[model samples]
Target: MYELKEREMIFVFTGPHGAGRKTVAEMSGSTLGIKQVISCTTRPQRPTEVDGQDYHFITAEQFNEAQAKDEFIEVTRVNDYLYGIKNSDIEKIFKSSGSIYLILNRFGAETLQALYGDHVVRIFIYADRDTLEQRMRESGDSEELIATYLSHYEDEMAYREQCEHVFENVDLAHTVFDLTKTLDQYLNRNLLELD
Candidate 1:
């Protein structure tokens, strides 16, 4: 049987862009009462996102200043935009919850694991190339950027084995179900009262 230690855990979901990492993380966080780490980003916020909720949208200068202060636990540059998770945010969650969900890039996920050791549960998510492209397009990404992401997909997927669990996100609802079930088994909880 699969096992995760009994304690509040840091759940980090990561994968190539358009693989539904954020979608699944949001669903799981809502259902399981897990706090999510809202990352700070230099990218423009989408219309559907609210400031401080989906992300803490910031200027590049602000991001740079924070980075210089050693405030972020991990930082990555994607398509020229900077994305990072604040160290204080993770520390607060660790002190206050049964679990916390982090939607991260592969680099951020790796950094979390290295920093937190056994308290971190890494879940790698992915989908077929066509599905990835479709999701990216649906999100209004430009063709040039989509191509760039596609080109990096293989390299991103190569980190799969380094993760503690891996899921292929083919269908959002079904995938969410499976992920929550896996989390229930992993953390030993009826996280959503599904029983």
Candidate 2:
């Protein structure tokens, strides 16, 4: 049986589609030496995405089976696809790292906060609608996909006030720099308290 030596710090990044939450999370994780909590999804993989790297792409049956077994820590349905984080995945990260970041939607982040309490930090990222649309187009998203994402944008943005930190991600470099710096300070302060 494996056990974590210390409580893990969970940073949850939530935002509307094309707001660059995933990109910022990845960059901040790399800069801070923190691992990412990759999620499992039933959605079809994009052309540039890797199966296990970007997401654990599974069949709907597989997702249902996992859910039936109570394997998911947080799960949600979006656009008819299931997305979830597995308990085992967090355990795997905690075996080697003390902190991890998750790219999640508002509901997923809320679930994590309910489970982890103070160990969870919720950060909301956003950009103007025009900027978001431009980003999706530049990333090769289909017009249909862009439309679907934008349709839900306002609803997602409404959750921004519920987050602990909010960032306007107009400039990727600045956002990544500020985010990583903030995370570093937070971790250091928490570690000192633990000591």
Candidate 3:
């Protein structure tokens, strides 16, 4: 028997590279008026990124401190980098609205769902392999790397079933409209007002 709880939820989204899940999640979070649970990372700051805008861009020492304190909802190593979404960010989002969204890796989504139960709504984003490769090339990665990454898609295909929703990010041109529609449905409202 399953009982539904009405507490605030964590709307998590995951996808393969160049699928635009991160962009869609950010837009959805902004539209919903909740903090998007931006993570802290050990990766170097990119040219367009501020100290904390894109990521916390912390040193290994700082990240280790927070990790030791168990301050993160999920933490993992990805692409030779340390990435973590802090519990404080989750608390911040929940404090403001009836629901919160976290853009996470597939692993994080599963971990959070296990801990939060029905409070976690997972969305898996997908794009055709060719389109994904094209987008990755446009984003400046080498073709070889893009091909290597795309090869993993087949192995990771089963992960999509783990999510509550599977979004196909085909045409990048109309991504906003599609994302907005999904958010509206997920929140069950045309307008989401943040507290």
Quickly count the clashes in candidate 1.
Answer: 0
Per-residue error for 117 in candidate 1, Å, reads 1.1
Give TM per candidate: 0.88, 0.92, 0.83
Question: Arrange candidates by TM-score, highest first: which order?
Answer: 2, 1, 3
lDDT of 3 by residue, 1-195 (tens): 122247566788887877888787777777666566678999887665777666889999999999999887678787678999887776665665777776667777888888888777888888878888888888887777787678777655579987788878776446756666776765677764334
Query: Which regions of candidate 1 deviate over 4 angstroms?
Result: 1-6, 191-195
Give the Å shift of residue 132 in candidate 2. 0.4
As a whole number from 0 to 100, the lDDT of residue 180 in candidate 2 is 77
Report, for every candidate in turn, its global Cα lDDT versus the true structure.
0.85, 0.89, 0.75
Query: What does the lDDT come to for candidate 3?
Result: 0.75
Clash pairs, model 1 backbone: none
Better of 2 and 3 by lDDT: 2
lDDT of 1 by residue, 117-142 (tens): 88888999999899999988998888
lDDT: which candidate is best? 2
Off by over 4 Å in 3: 1-5, 143-148, 172-179, 190-195
Choose 1 or 3, whichever is better by lDDT: 1
- As a whole number from 0 to 100, the lDDT of residue 126 in candidate 1 is 98
In model 2, the worst 10-residue window by lDDT is 186-195
